[model samples]
Target: MNQRIRNCAAAAGLLFTAMTASAANYTAMLTGPKEAPPNSSTGMGAAFVKFDAASHVLEVDVAFGGLLGTTTAAHIHCCTDTPNTGTAGIATETPTFGGFPLGVTSGAYSNTYNTSLAASWNPAFLSSHGGTTAGAESAFAAGLASGAAYLNIHSSLYPTGEIRGFLTGAAPPVPEPASFAMLGLGVPAMLLVARRRRKA
Candidate 1:
């Protein structure tokens, strides 16, 4: 019985480690009201972001419409002083995301960034965070986890930022295949051991 308990605890530890190492998903509903110093532009947008710490990959998707002015730039800002409020400097590519739609009131964008590369981060942001891609990646991930990261879209009408939203949501971690297999075998074995002890 003691041996069985040890085995079960080991399996649980494996599962916990695997789950904690997985990727995270985040989403935001962008609107003028969510913007700092709120606007009345009637524009709306949505953003979806996924980050894989192990792979150092960041994926971003955005859709927006009904803007009062043409699109100018869009990027992510991070490490706000307060969560879900306030403003922060851009943490993503400068000017705008690569291949982002320009001069359009409504558009959709999808892009994947290799966060391991310098091109994926704003120069100032990267410099401030220990001047390395790894440092920037770590800081960005922390910002997202703490609700201090946001997606913003700038327009001709509101160059500072017409519509924006704080990114929220940290998906439950998923266990790796090996961890799943361990749980599958360990759980049944644990139950069998318990049943035998009960019979005894």
Candidate 2:
């Protein structure tokens, strides 16, 4: 391609990136949720979460080695930063996603993560549900920027929380607030500048 064409392509690419970035997101720090024991002997597995601010949705995927005889209750509660400190919060109820309850409050959970529990990816889930929702990329950004957000797993074995983590930061690639903002503006501005330069 010609130099002029290449420059324009680059500018278009940058703009595309800006629009793709959502509000907040997160990812698993360590793969513990997978190896950790379940809240109950009946429960044993790891839970994974991912979210996208652009789509305004969270996905809660849990892989249990097995479940209690009847799968009674499950919940995603909040506790101290370090395991077993103090009860920070808990998930009272969950809205249905697809056919399963998008929640982590009862021990007998239906194991459904692909759901839009919250109409939008507000930081509220962090203060309340913790490890329950799609606390991945955008979730972390929104939660931390807003202040307060976390993750947790609960079951009949451990009513409070078997495993938990904080939504302190996002996985990566998701631009930081400042970065996102700059790109959101910078790319367009650059294109305008380029057009003017070509005209001149």
Top lDDT hit: 1
Candidate 2: 10-residue stretch with minimal lDDT: 105-114
- Candidate 2 at 149: error in angstroms? 4.4
Q: On residues 144-193, what C-alpha lDDT tens digit does candidate 1 reach at each position?
A: 99999999999999999998989988432333455334334433343344
TM-score (all chains, Cα) for each model: 0.75, 0.40
lDDT of every model, 2 decimals: 0.82, 0.38
Kindly report which residue stretches of model 1 are placed more than 4 angstroms away from their true locations once superposed: 1-21, 170-200
TM-score of 1: 0.75
Q: Write the per-residue lDDT of candidate 2 for residues 105-184, one digit (tens) a residue.
A: 22211222323444332345544446444553333444444424444444344444444444433332332454334334
What alpha-carbon RMSD in Å does predicted model 2 have with respect to the real structure? 15.2
In candidate 2, position 187 carries an lDDT of: 32
Clashes (backbone N, CA, C under 3 Å), per candidate, total: 0, 29
